[model samples]
Target: MSPGADAPDTGRFALRGRIVTLDPADTVLDDGVLYVSGTLIEAVLPATAPAPPGFAGVTPLDTRGSVYPGLIELHNHLPYDVLPLWQVPKRYGNRSQWGGSGNPAYRTLVTGPMKVLGQDPRLMPAVVRYVEAKALVNGTTTSQGIALFSNAGARRMYRGVVRNVEQTDTPDLPEAASRIADVEAKDAEKFLARLKQPHRLLLHLAEGTDAAARAHFQALQFQPGKWAITENLVGIHCTGLNADDFTVFAAHGGSMVWSPLSNLLLYGKTADIAAAKEAGVLMGLGSDWSVSGSKGLLGELKAARLASTAAGSVFSDRELVAMVTRDAARILRWESALGSLGAGMRADLVVVAGTHGDPYTSLVDARDEDIRLVAVDGVARYGSGRLMRALAPGENLEPVPGTAGEHVLRLDDGTADTIVAGLSLGEATERLAGALADLPALAATPVPPITASPGGGVRWQLALDEIEPTGAELRPRLPLLSASGETHPTGPGIGALTAAPAELEPVALDALTASDDPVFLATLAGEGNLPADYAGALARLLT
Candidate 1:
C-alpha cells in the first residue's frame, strides 16, 4: 500500500467537539479531540488530552458544536442534468389528472429536452449549482453519478448522424439530424470527462435487457482493475446480466449501486439483489429519481429494509448505513479519503443534534431535517453558523447572514434540545419533488408504423412513421393486423422492427439466430439501418 495517495499530510490539528466519527467503528466522541496530520489520522484523544508538543502551528478547532465526514451518494447521474421543476406535466396539455404533480413529461419529452440540454453547457452548470446548493445544505459532499449516453455512445452517435447527413441530398433535414447528434455527443463526452476528475463518479451505464446490458459491458471489454485505477465508475441498477458480467465487474473490485425504488418505477423488476450479495460484490443503495414519490435516499433505505426483511435478508441497520456511507466510499474508491472519521480523512462531518435512542433506529427513522452540519474537505458547506459562533469569541463574532443562532427543538418528552440545525420533513419532500420535476422526459410520441419485409416467414419490418428518441428502456408494440382484420400475436425486437434498408440483413440474421427460442424479424422501411456486427452478436446468441 503506497501510503494511499489520498492520505492527509503530516500536521497536527485538534478537532474538539461532538463528532459523529464513522471510523474503524461507529464512535460518537463527546468533548472529543482528534489529532491529524499529512492526511492520516494520528490519534482520537479526549478533549482533555494535552496538545502534542511542537504542534504550535496547528489550528485548534472548537468542534464542541458539530463535525463529521463528508457524505457519499453511491449511485447518481452526473451529466444527465435534470432541472429543478422543469419537466413536470404542468408544461404539457395532453397530460392527464392521474399524472400527479410530479414530472410527467419525463417520459414524453425525453428526446427533445435531452437533445436541447445536450447542446448547451450552461444547462448542466445551472442544474448542478442548484443541486449542489441543496446537497451541501443537506450534508452531501461526494456523489457517484452514472450519466446518460456515456462518451462512447456520444461519439458513435455523432459519427453516425454526420455520415447519415453527408450522404443525404436534403439540406435542412440532414443538417438538423447532424446537429442533434453532434450536440448529444459533445455534451455527453464533456460532462462525463469532467465528472471523472472528481473524487467520486459513478456514471451509470444502465441498459434494459440482458443482451443490451451485456452489449454495454462488453463495450468496456470487462477489463480488470480499471475502475480501481481511475477510482471512478460505480455501476448502478444493472440487471439481466449473465455470470460473466459479474465476473468482469468483480475483477475491477468496483462497487455495485442498487436503486430498488427507481428500478421498480421504470422497469417492472430490479436487479438480482441476492445474486449480487452472493458474489461478494460491495453494495450501496440510492434513492434514484424518488421525487415522483416525494422521497430521497433515507426513504430509499427504509424501503430497502422492508424489502430485504420480507426476503429474509440478514443485513443490519449498521450495514445499511454503510451502504450510504462506508460501502459507498468503497464504491467511489475513496475509502481512504472519505466514508470514515479517521484522522487523515477530511473533517467533513455531520451532527444530528445529539446521539441517543438506538443509533441505528434513529438513523433509519430520522428525516433529512435531522442533519445538523455538513462539511466537505474540512470546510463547512452547511450548518457553519452555530459551529462558527461556538468556536469564535463573542467580540470576534461578525455579522453572519445565513448563520442564525441555534434552534430549540422540542421533543415528545416535554423536553427541548437546542441544536444548531436540522432538516424539516415537509421541506425535504418538497425539495426532492421540486428537483425531480426538472428531469427530462423519457416518453415519446407514438408514430405510424412503416412496414419493410413482409416475407414468407412471420417476419414483417415495421418502422416508426417518424424518428423518436429512446431512453434507458425501449418497449414498443407494433400492431400487426392481417388481411382478415385479425392482429398477429407476434411482435419483433426493436432493433429488428426499426432496421433501415442497410440494417435489414443483420437485423434479420439476429432475429433468426440470436436466441434458442424462435424470433420474429421485421424492419421499418426507412429508419436508420442496423449494422453487420449487431447481426453477428445476435448470431452468437443463437448459436
Candidate 2:
C-alpha cells in the first residue's frame, strides 16, 4: 500500500472561514467563502466578492476557526499502533541492535503480539477499524496504506474512510507503491526500474544513527558513481545520512520522511533534517507507529517543532506546516490535485477552533480537542458532534470521547475492505480492547481458516509488512558486503521475522485521541530515551 489515495461523495456545501491557502503566493484569506460542489472545491472567493451563481440558496457553515489543507502522513505502521508505547530498554545506535533478540522482551512486547493479531480473522478488522479511527480523529486525511491479504494469496490494500495512498482508483489521485517485490528488490537494476513505474516509492531508508545504518544508504550506490535512487523515491527516516549524503540525495531529486520521535526513542537521535533542508531536499513528517512514536500526526508536528527548536530553528512554523501539506504533496507528485486550498482542488481540509495568533502555529500547536472538522472529498468524516449533526446529517455516525467536548466520527463502512466495512467503530473498539486485555487467551484460541473462494469464501487478514514471506519488507533490503565478504541484508532477519511467541501478557488497547489519553503524556515524561524537556514542552503545547 508505496503507501498512500481517495473519491467523490456528491454533495454541495458552502464553508466560510479563514482559509490558509498553501498556494504559490501563500495567501491567507480572512473571511473567505469556500464553495464545495461534488467533492471538488467550486471556488475560494473573498467574502466581499459577489457569490458565484452556484451559491443559490445554500446555507453556509461558518467554521469559526481556521481551515488548512488536510494533514498528509507520508509514513506510518497502522496495525502495530494498537499496541501501547514500548518503554525501550536503552538507546541503541541502529535498528538491528535493538530489534534483535538481545532484548528478551522483544518477543513478548512487540513481534509476538503482532504474530497472533495478524493471523486471527476475528481480530484483524478490529485492528484496521480502530487504527484508522485513531488517525481520522486526529485530522489525518491521507496516509500510507494498510496491506491485507487473504489465505488464498490474494492481496488488497485496505481502503477505509481515510484516503490510502496505495490504492486510489481515481484518475487524478495516482496510486503509489510502498513495497518492492522481492525479485525486483534483490536485483538492483530492477529496483531502479520499479521506482520509475509509480508516482512514488516510499521505502524505509537509513533508519538508525550509526555506521551500520549509514551503510544502508551507501548500498544504494549500486555502481561506483551512479545511485539507484530517483525523484520518485521517498525515503523514510534518513537518520544515517550526513550533509554530503543529503546533498547527493537532493541532486537525485529524492525526498525523505522524518520520524524524529521514533528515531529518538530507539536510536537516541533523529535524521539530520538541518542537512536535508540545506541540501534543498524535500521532507515530510511520519508518526512511525504508536508503540514508540506519536498516537497521531498532529502529535508528530509538535515533536518536529521541538526538534527544529533544538536545531536552532532551521524551519519556521510556516515551513514546518508546508512539510505536512504542500511539500508533502509535491513529494508524492500530487500538488496539482491536492495539498492546497484553491478553486478546482479537492475539498480536503481540517478546521481548528479560534483564528487567534499565528494560524500555522495554532495548527501545529493544536491538540485533538481543537480540531473541529476534518473533511475528505468535500464530505465531513470526523468533527465535533454539533458540526457533524449539521453537515453530515444523513450518514450513520459514531460518538467518540474528548477532553473538552464530545466529538463524533462519520465513516462510510462501504470501503474497499469489505471485511471491515460491516463492523462499526464501537464494536471494533470493544473487540480490540477485550482481545488485547487478554493476549495469552486470545493467542491460545484457534483461528478459523479462511476459505479460498470469493462469494462467502474469502476473508481478509492483516498483512504484517515486517513479517517475512507475507509482503514487501518495510525497510529497504539493499544488500551489503560484510567484512567477511558475505552479503548481509539491511532489513529484518529471518529469525527476527519468525519470532515464536513468548508467554503472552495482557495489554490495554491504545487510546484513540491524545487529548483523552493522559497516560500518553505521562509515559513520555518518564520515558528515558526522550529529551528531558520534550514532555513538559509538549504538555504546555497540548494542554
Candidate 3:
C-alpha cells in the first residue's frame, strides 16, 4: 500500500494501551487511547480523557502492552525463508564466490535441486507466502523487497507494504533500483538524473573485505565534476567501507541499511557503524535473508543492538527502535504516513507485552512471544487467536500448533491463508529445520575448481590441469549463470525448490511449520480492571 492513502473505512473503533508515540520528542502515554476512524487515526488521547461523543457505542480493545508504530523493514529478500542458516565451510572473498561454481554447497543444495523446484509456478507462490507470514509474525508492518507473488484480482494476502508492481519498465524511470554491479556509468548518470525527481537507489556496496568489494564503493562514490546528487542513495552491507568512504557518503546525505548478523556471518566483520553515525549518515536495520541473517527484523534488531554495544558505541533503546520505524520510513520516503503514531496518520501499529516503566527497554528486549498484536491500515491482521476472534468475529480463526507446542492463529484473506501467529525469535529456525527434514535426498554435484589470478579475477573450469581424472563420472548440476546470464537464486537462496515432492502439501506443510504463539492478555471494551493474576490470565488465554 502506498503511504498515507486512506484505506477504505472498515469501521471505527478504539484501542487503549500504553502508547509509545515516536513523535519528534518520543512521547510516551502510560495509558493512551487511540481512536481509529476507518484507516486513519482519528485521535490520540490519554485514557483518562473522555471519549469523543461519536465514539460512545464503539468498543475499545484494551491491551496489556505498549502500542507503537509498526516496524518498517527497509531491506529484505523474502523468498529465502525456506533455508535457515545455510553457509559454506568457510568465508568466501565475495558474494560471487559464495554463489558461483566454486562453492560445493551452492551447486548441490541451492543451484541443482532448488533451481529445479523454483521453476515450479505452483510451489513458488507457496514459498513466497510463507516468507511474508514470517515477517508479519515478527511485527514488521511494512517491508520492501522484490515482489515474487502476484496479488492481482485477489484480496491482499500479505498485508504489510504491498508494492509488487515491477518498476523496471517505467518510462519515467524507476522509483528504486538495486545491485550496484548492474548499474554502469551510464546507468549511474541516469540514476543521478532520477534523484532530481522523487527516487531511491539501493545498491549492495562494500559487502566484503576483498578489493573487489572495496572497488564497488569507489564506483558508487560521486566524481568531483561528473555527479552531485547523493541524498536518494541507500547502500546495503558496507562492511568494507573506511572512514574516508563514510565521510563521502555522509557529506552527500547518503544513508545505509545495516545487516549486522549477515555481515558478521559472511565476513567476520561488520560496517564501521560508529563512524557512519558520527558522519551523520542515517542508518536503518535489515535482515538480509534466512541464509545468513536472523529470523526477521526483531532478531536483526537484537543483533544490531549487540553489535553496537560490542563496538563501544551503543544506540539508545529508543534510537534503536527508530532505526526500524521512523528512520527506515524516511529512507523509503514514506514518513508522512507510515512511521509514527499521530492523528491523521495511517493506523499501522504494533502492540507488545511490556511491564517495564520505560517502553523502549521493553521493545528492545521483546521477543516474538512478546508481540501481542500487529495492525496495518487500522485492521488487526495478526495477533493471538483470542485477539483475532475479538477483532473480526465474521472471519474464521483457526488455531495451528507450532513445533514448540505453541498455538498460532491462521487467517485466510481470500488469496492465501496467512499465519498471523506470534513467533518466538527462534521459532522460524526451528520450523525451517522441520520443513527441511521432510525433503527427499538431494543429489550431489562435483564442485568446479576455481583458479584465481594475481589480479583477483576468478576463472571457473570443469577440470584442473594438476588433477587426474578417475573412473568416477562427474556431472555439473546447473550452470553457474542461467540462460539470461543471471546467477542462480538471483536475489536469495530458494530452499523449497529442492525439497521432497511428497512434502509439497502447501496448506498442511505451512500448518506444521507455524511458529509458536506469544502470551496475550487483553480485555474487551467496557471490561473491568485486568485480572489480579496477569500470568494466569495469559495461560488461560493460551489454553
- Rate residue 14 of model 3 by lDDT: 85
Model 2 stretches with alpha carbons more than 4 Å out: 1-10, 413-416, 448-456, 482-500
> For this target, which candidate reaches the highest TM-score against the unseen true structure?
2
- After superposing candidate 3 on the true structure, give the runs of residues whose Cα lies further than 4 Å from its correct spot: 1-9, 146-187, 225-229, 403-411, 414-543
- Model 2, residue pairs in steric clash: 2-177, 2-178, 3-145, 4-164, 4-165, 4-166, 5-164, 5-165
Residue-level lDDT for 450 in candidate 2? 58
The sequence of per-residue lDDT tens digits that candidate 2 reaches over residues 1-543 is 221233435478887789899887899987887888878888888877877776878877888988999899999889988888888878888777766555557667777677777778778888888888888888899888888888687887776778877776777877777887776666567777887775788888887888988988887777767888899999999999999999999999899999888988888788888899999999999999998898878999988999888878888999888988998889888898889999889877899998878878989989889999998887788888878888887778788855368788886643436667678788888888888788888778757655576666666787776544544666666787577655775665532634444577888788987767777778777778777787688767766
lDDT of 3 by residue, 1-543 (tens): 222233334588888888888988888889888888777788888988888767988777887789989887767766555554554366655565565544555544444433323323333334554666667777787665433222121112233233221132222213464422222322445555645555676656667877656655654434443433378778788887888788888887789999987776666668898888888889888887765665677777776777777688568878899998888878766677667888888788888876457888778677667777777777776676656667767764444345332324433443222322233223444444443453343122222223333664432111110012221111111113334544342232212223232222211122222134221111111122212342232233232
Estimate candidate 2's alpha-carbon lDDT, on a 0 to 1 scale.
0.81
Clashes of each: 39, 8, 3
Q: Estimate each model's TM-score.
A: 0.51, 0.94, 0.72
Runs with alpha carbons beyond 4 Å of true place in candidate 1:
1-20, 25-31, 35-43, 52-67, 78-104, 107-125, 144-233, 242-254, 289-299, 388-543
> Which scores better on TM-score, 1 or 3?
3
For each candidate in the order shown, give its overall lDDT on alpha carbons: 0.40, 0.81, 0.58
lDDT at position 74, candidate 1: 52
In model 3, which residue pairs have backbone atoms overlapping below 3 Å? Answer: 1-162, 439-500, 440-500
Error of 3 at 204 (Å): 1.2
